[model samples]
Target: MHHDSLHALLVKEKLSLTRPRRIIFDLLLHKDPQSMQVLISRAANKVDRATIYRTIELFERLGIVHRLNIGWKYKIELSDLFVGHHHHFHCNQCGATHTLQANPMLETMIDTVAAKENFSPRSHQLEIHGLCGQCAGQPA
Candidate 1:
């Protein structure tokens, strides 16, 4: 997304576009979903840990980022505002996460199930967990 759009989103959300928030937001734009530790390390004391956590929480609440529950812990990533809806493939062995394009078939199935149950579906999250190529190639 463009800088203007990001700024506009902050404004619309009633959030201040502070320096730390802007820096972290820009970092997220270029990087994939990251853990709190990873984000703090990347910040390198440029932004405090509490501020980073608060910013991430605010972004998640604003629908600007997705807080993913990948079993062991939670990860944060830019939401559909920047990229379209997508799934994730998590490598259990290596602890790596890969993005997958949205699957129309799966979405249809979910919608069908919701319809069958007379439930209105707002959104859904799907994560496939397994060993990645490099991990699978290694000795078990």
Candidate 2:
């Protein structure tokens, strides 16, 4: 989404457009989903860890960001509200993440299961963990 839209969203949510919050949001705007530690490091001491952590938590709570548990750590990214729903392929060996757009087959499977169990699904995330091409070619 555009920066102006993001600013508008903050206003719509009644969230103050603070420098720390804007800085972190801007970073996420440029980069893909990032871990808390990576976000902190990129801030380069311009923002404090506690503030970044707090802002992240607030963003998640406000549906401005989506948090993914990639087994080892939590990664934060823009939510479907802004970017649309998607999935990821995480390379377990090198800690790389590749975004995957919505798949019809996967969606059908989820819908079938939900119907079978009489469950109303709200949202879903799929993270496929395996070796990337380079890692797969390397001998153990």
Candidate 3:
């Protein structure tokens, strides 16, 4: 997303575009979902740990970022506003991951299932875990 959009979002929310926040935002932009530790490492001498955590929390609450949960652990990424809604594919053996774009058929199935269960559909996430092609191609 554009810097102007970020500034507009903050202005609309009555929040200031602080330096730390900008640093964090720039780090996340055009990036894949990654852990906070990875983000902290990338930030290096820029933003501190606590501030990054707080800013991430704020961003999550403001829909600026989406948390991808793998059981209890999670990674953060730019929200749909910045990167369209998507699922995930994980290689359990190599710990590699790939982004899966939202599929209309899959979404229709989800909506149908929710309707059957009399539940309102808000959002959903799916993670398929298995060996990636390269790993699978390798002999045991």
Candidate 4:
């Protein structure tokens, strides 16, 4: 996305484009999505942890990023790329996350469960954890 488009998104979401928030959004746009610790470490200008967390929270609310529950810790990433629906797989060793393009089986399972439990499923997120191919073959 272009800088102008991103800025428009912030405005459409009724969000202010502060320095820290812009940097964080730009980092996610250019680099791979990362955890807060990684983002903070890569920041050129020192940013408070609280500010980072707050920006993340606001971005999440605005649908600019998705806060993924990757089991051990929270992982966030850009979400506007996907058209319909998708899932993710995270490498436990290298911390790399890949978007899964298809997962009909999982969707069916969720639908079945919702029907059996008589609960309406508004939304759901799935994160599978494992070593990526490179990490799996590496010697520890």
Candidate 5:
């Protein structure tokens, strides 16, 4: 989606259309999922670390994006295109993150396990870390 559209949506959601916020949101929306470190490095300006973290926190709370607990920090990406629950796969070697379509069977299994253990499952985040296809084929 265009940055303009994203900005409009944020405005509609009663969020301030600040330059740093817009830039961060647009970058995450257009590019693949990335960790906080990578995003900071690639950002056009030397945005303060606190600023980026706070922006991400606001965006996540507003349902504009979702965070996947993976790697050293976390991976974040646009949440509009994603629906329902699903698993995420993060490559340790390449630091690439991708979403796996939600599996009803897996969801059911998790539910059953929770019930059996008498644990209240609020939510779950799963990641299979390994070398992706490209990285696995290349000489290590």
Candidate 6:
């Protein structure tokens, strides 16, 4: 999404488009998923850790981003409201994360299971944690 549109979103939410928030938003806008450490280090204007953490918490609370917990740590990215429904391949060895495209077969399986259990499903998330290509000693 455009930065202007993001600004408008903040306006609609009656939230201030603060400099730290804007920097964090732009970071998530381009990348897929990023760790807090990566975000703190990559922020252009050197936003402090406490401010970035608070911004991330705020975004998650507002449904603007999804927090994918990796053990005690986590990564943050734009939620499905802004992006498409998909899964994640998280590298256990190196902590790298790669996006997995949405699969129709998986959707079919989920629907089948829900029908069998008579369950009403609203939303779901999947994260496959293992060694990524590079960590597995192959091309990434």
* Residue 29 local lDDT, model 6: 85
**Model 5: C-alpha RMSD to truth?**
3.5
Better of 2 and 5 by TM-score: 2
Which candidate, 5 or 6, has the higher lDDT?
6
lDDT of 4 by residue, 1-140 (tens): 45566577788968667788778877787444577778878774667788888888887777778877765777778765423467788888877888776578888898889978898887787777888889999946
Model 5 quality (TM-score): 0.70
- Candidate 3: residue 100 Cα off by (Å): 0.4
Q: lDDT winner among the candidates?
A: 3
- Candidates in order have lDDT scores of 0.85, 0.84, 0.87, 0.75, 0.76, 0.84
Q: Model 5, range 1-140, lDDT digits (tens) per residue? A: 35666677678888778878877876786566788888888774657778998988887877778887775577788774434466777777877776787788998888889989999887776677877888889957
Scanning candidate 5 in windows of ten residues, the lowest lDDT window is 80-89
Q: What global local distance difference test value does model 5 have?
A: 0.76
**Model 1 regions lying over 4 Å from their true place:** none
* lDDT, candidate 1, 1-140, per-residue tens: 45677788889977678899888888788566888888889998799989998899888887788888877688889998888888899998888888988989989998899989999988888889998889999946
Residue pairs with backbone overlap in model 1: none
Total clashes in model 2, counting residue pairs 3 or more apart in sequence or in different chains: 0
**Candidate 5 residue-wise lDDT at 129:** 80
TM-score (all chains, Cα) for each model: 0.91, 0.89, 0.91, 0.71, 0.70, 0.85
Candidate 3 at 30: error in angstroms?
1.4
Position 130, candidate 1: lDDT:
92
Count of backbone clashes, every candidate in sequence? 0, 0, 0, 0, 0, 0
Locate the minimum summed-lDDT window of 10 residues in model 1.
1-10
TM-score top scorer: 1
- In model 2, what lDDT does residue 47 have? 97
